[model samples]
Target: MPRHLLKLSDLAPAEARQIVLRASALKRQADSGYRPFVGKTLAMIFTKNSTRTRVSFEAGMARFGGHALFLAAGATQIGRDEPLRDTAQVLSRMCSAVMIRNDSQRDQEEFAAHSRVPVINGLSDLHHPCQLLADLQTWFEHRGDPRGKVAAWIGDGNNVCHSFIEAATLFGFTLRIAAPAGYQPDAAVMGAAGDAAQLADSPAAAARGADLIVTDTWTSMGQEAEQQKRLQAFAGYQVDAALMQLAKPDAIFLHCLPAHRGEEVAAEVIDGPQSLIYDEAENRLWAQMALLEFLFGIAA
Candidate 1:
């Protein structure tokens, strides 16, 4: 009876758009004394480190008048070899909803399968739907509908790239991803996305005349050991001024934050006038509040 947001494609296109619209509305009324979760609780289980993901969800719950319980996987039985099914069942009983940021998509799937409450995937190796929701909301606010717009993704084809691929399918945008040969997105995901997505051999090629330019770190959280190798592979892929020039003059730039200053993007570009990085970061709260309201069936 409860909805689960395990991936972006889990929602119909209309439903996804509705959530984005709601996020915009919520942002307008952020200080209007709204508290939809006065007597509710949300359980946030984290198996990985976070900055925006943890803060946005926790703050969003507080703003909704709900209590958010932070559970570090290492401090809970989940890290002590307890079965995920048990954790899911226990939390579903005590909490209004459950969120998990973990490495294995299968584990999140198993947890959602047994959860009696709504389940949200905060983060996973396969997809990052929440961030994509915020990104979509930001784009919509600035440029209206993204349908037929060109979105260029330059850098590692990680989870964020994976979600962009799904978004291209759902939102009718063409996504051009430029990554090193060995770092391309999963083949099945690309296959599913079909004509909505394509691969480019270079960042310039992808950015050419694009309406929106986005990128992420060359190395992700769990890939510290391969940092040097990634640096070498992604040597020419940084979203610098030259890359930005390839896109339309007024094209907006975005990067999901905690960005390495001189790595994935140049200092000037991320801090420049064209970057919507800060707005994109702040929208995480508004966008996720809409998701929570949707899952809880609350009308605003």
Candidate 2:
């Protein structure tokens, strides 16, 4: 069976840590002309639009001497109602690996089950594992191991937050999340994390004494219909200068971008000195390269 990254928990703690370390090394040697993936091809399937995810994966493949094929769901047979299992089997036969950015986690799992090649989750409604890898790499680059650190998540406890909860368990960190009552993360995900994750009464409570602060857009791709309602619900949860100040003096801020500057986060904080959003974004390439190497059984 091919190893797949369907969620953060799919990787053992040590494996995840190793990937981050490898990513850091790859970042340093980015211009060294190394090409482990020569002649290989990665098939990328997208059910939703993307910017960073598409660019980072395509760039990573090109930098490693591999080719990447972009397949929009609507342009492919997938849009014609062909089963995902059939598509997965076909892609697995022709491609070295498969990366999918889709809305349903169940569909992703079904595809992965039928795949012969490693399957990577670009993003799903339940978790954004790839983003978590980049976030881990960025954190490690700036602050070393996150084991004993406190991370505060402010805003809707959506997919990113769910992955962060899993990451806290795997990486041995404490994750405090603050979301409006109806917007809290999935109960089962929080339960699985046990004491590693907790709920705070408010954003201020979550940020207090935290070593890392994070947030994401109030309205995600498929949530456009609920935009105005979300805006109102998340009005007081913005990660502005005041909320950031509640964390430790040297604490860093992270966001899975395409940010609503004045909404989920403040422009000052996102573009501020302590914010590592760019680094976090750039690490997506290196982290994903490391992931590809791991999936293909390539030596670092």
Candidate 3:
């Protein structure tokens, strides 16, 4: 059976660790004669706009000698009456794998159910497993294993936060999330995290003694209309130098990019020496490359 990484929970603890390790080796290999995807093709479907998602997957495929076909929502019949199952079945026959960045979790589930090849959740309303994979790889590069470390998350408990919660459980880390009253993560996700995750009273509280500090934009792609409201609610949640001071002296900061310079994260913190945001962003390529190799059964 083909494996589908709809969420971090899809990979067992050992498997996730192996992927991280493989990502490091893949990065070292670079484009030095590795061509696992020669003659293979990956179909990429984008229901939402993208930057990193599109570039990383396209580049990764080309690096492996594979082709990536980009399909916009309206460009394909999926925007009209073509059933997702039909799209999945048809694509599965032609492509070696499928990756989708969508607005709904259910839609991704439906696509995976009908897909014959591996299906990767490029991004979704409920999870961004690809980003989490990159983040984990970054952590492993700087520090050793993050199994017993504490990671603090600040700002809106959005899709990225949901994946962090899942990662905490799968990677054996403690996740401390501090969000405003009404902006907490989903109850079911929090419930599933159990003792591995907790809500702190404030960003400072969560960052206290943490090994990693992470935050994302207060408003995501679809929440543009609520930008002002979200800005107000997340006003005091910025991951600035002051908050970083509360964490371990060696603790690193990370922000999934296209970040607002002065909003969710302050300029000083993200641009500081301890910030690993750029490295984290670059790891998306290596991590996804490892993922594709794993899904295609080319990696041990």
Q: Quick one: how many clashes does candidate 2 have?
A: 0
lDDT of 3 by residue, 98-188 (tens): 9999998899999999999999999999999999999999999999899989999999998999999999999999999999999999999
What is candidate 2's lDDT per residue for 90-179, written digit by digit as tens? 999999999999999999999999999999999999999999999999998898889999999999999999999999999999999999
lDDT of 1 by residue, 175-289 (tens): 9999998999999999999999999978999999999999998888899999999999999999999999999998999999889989999999999999999999999999999
TM-score of each: 0.99, 0.99, 0.98
Off by over 4 Å in 1: none
- Candidate 2 wrongly placed segments (more than 4 Å): none
For candidate 1, give the lDDT: 0.94
Q: What's model 2's overall lDDT?
A: 0.96
Model 3 score (lDDT): 0.93
RMSD in angstroms, all models? 0.8, 0.6, 0.8
Candidate 1, poorest ten consecutive residues by summed lDDT: 250-259
- Residue 71 deviation, candidate 3, in Å? 0.5
Clashing pairs in 3: none
